[model samples]
Target: MPFDFSQSHFVLFGLPTTFALDRAVLDTAYRKLQAEFHPDRFAAADDAQKRLSLQIATRVNEAYQTLKSPLARARYLLQLNGVDTQEDTNTAMPVDFLMQQMEWRETIADAKTQRNVDELEELNRQLAEEITELTVELAELLDEQHAWSDAATAVRKLRFLEKLNDEIGNAIEAVLF
Candidate 1:
């Protein structure tokens, strides 16, 4: 009841406003808030109290989900400041980046066609390493450097890596089946 429904997630939880969050603190805040505002805790109260509890609970869930993922957190921060991160509108990736992606896709396709598990595993390993590097780059841009523009670029790279990850998984499944 003391917490304001009008507050943002960081404000509601009395947390600092930042792109990179401490997971432990976030989890603790989420658990504490959920326990405080859970509808079950308001079941014995009047109808209005129960309804308010439900709304607060829903807000908490939305905040938790948005703050938990790097991609979602970045997007939320941009939206919070009235910025449209129209990643798709740019549609102009460097040609070298596109070529690299195509090469990886081709390598994956060839590996699957030959039922070469070793090649698939090696590709997966390389992709995983690359993704890890991209993650670090994103963290540095978003957290340490506070370079939102560069962070946006990093997000694009991360998205591409995510797509490649899915494609690699599909290739693995095909080889297995």
Candidate 2:
């Protein structure tokens, strides 16, 4: 079949529509698609064919990226289920989660102020654990339970944890530097 831009990313990659995916399968499929539609392969083709190849290649890359990240994959599944996470518009997280987030921020700020590499590393470990736990919860919600609303909440929490993880890495760099 010809390439179809309108198809879902999972459909494009011949993957099942779920949050849990095999990384090896995704990598193989992405590489196969890249080899098939890479713009370099179209150098000798007509201008229209080259343009089409470029477009298909771009779409393939976008799909690969979206499917590769756990958070992105969860969000895409939620969107497909008609659940708009709406990060900006829907900011109503549980009160306990909000408090925990504040605590993490304060801990980050304190670690930065003290220039404590060990403490930063500890925080990074903690965040990594939380990310792992949430990822499991997300998979259960999205794949087994089909709990779209809970999955949306899980996606938002994962986003926050990811941002915090990045900040912790930056703090570690600053301390080491």
Candidate 3:
């Protein structure tokens, strides 16, 4: 396929190395790369070429996945800037954020226990809004201000919000079924 295998994910997809990306552009590039390097297209080629095609296809898929998810993209951006998120080693969060998390969890537990679908839905809405806000802040931190440490902290918070959102989804399913 004449593609550089060692390129970063964003470079592979011809994307600018920024937190704020256009989804439509990413989607188009992903599809174009997949079509260009699809292994099936190399079915008639020599074994060596076929293997290369397979590797290329695998890399393409991996890059697409990393670029598509906001959490993954944020982490990748931080990594590109030589900033380790330290998500595991740095578990210490602000007390106010911790308190807010506890409150949300308590609300979730109560609503789930009571099978209150409406409350669960409302909480889900609020969580979505918070996620959106954090994402915007991350875009500014990573793209505009180049605040790597602040971006890393924001990424950690985003991960927590995503996990909590998943829990809310599970609770909604439990209450429904």
Candidate 4:
């Protein structure tokens, strides 16, 4: 149980430290590591070894979660490259993007007020498309161009979009139920 907390998530998973990754490879590595570090495998070992196994298993889970999520992975990569996402410290965005966000919010509000599931579904579709586009841009910025600042900005946008998506899902559920 040689645990190295200093190792990056990618290093822990034997992955290249980059934004772009093969999902299959990541999933396979995660499963392999999970099985290897599973506490049950060390159940008969000494207390110290069992504790170490639990710690290693927890670390592996955390690494897998962060590496699997696009937004988290992007943020981690930016941090590794010496860029702070400034998710809390910096809220500034392009005026147009801000306006778009406001408009989307209004649209969601309208749909909720009217109890229109169809409208909510349409809005969800649009938001998903926007999220997909932003994800592609994020990958390009982090992997190909190494645009740290822009990548940080993109991460903020994705965070907002994800929140909005969750809200939309909640609203839809409310309307249906």
lDDT of 4 at 107: 89
Give the per-residue lDDT of model 1 (tens digit) for 46-72. Answer: 999899899999999999998887777
Candidate 4 Cα lDDT to native = 0.94
RMSD of 3: 0.9
Question: Which portions of model 2 show Cα errors greater than 4 Å?
Answer: none
Q: Candidate 4: where are CA atoms >4 Å away?
A: none
For every model shown, the clashing-pair count is 0, 0, 0, 0
In order, what is each prediction's RMSD in angstroms?
Answer: 2.4, 1.2, 0.9, 0.9
Candidate 3: Cα lDDT at 18: 92
Q: What is the C-alpha lDDT of each candidate?
A: 0.82, 0.91, 0.94, 0.94
Put down candidate 3 lDDT per residue, 27-65, tens digits, no spaces: 999999899999999999999999999999999999889
Which 10-residue window in model 3 sums to the lowest lDDT? 1-10
What tens digits encode model 4's per-residue C-alpha lDDT throughout 1-177?
A: 677889999998899999889999999999999999999999999999999999999999999999999999999999888999999989899999999999989988899989999999999999999999999999999999999999999999999999999999999998889
Question: Which runs of model 1 end up more than 4 angstroms from their true locations?
Answer: none
Query: What tens digits encode model 2's per-residue C-alpha lDDT throughout 1-177?
Result: 278889999998899998889999999999999999999999999999999999999999999999999988988888888999877778788999889989988998898899988888998898899999999999999999998888888888899889989999988888889
lDDT of 4 at 115: 98
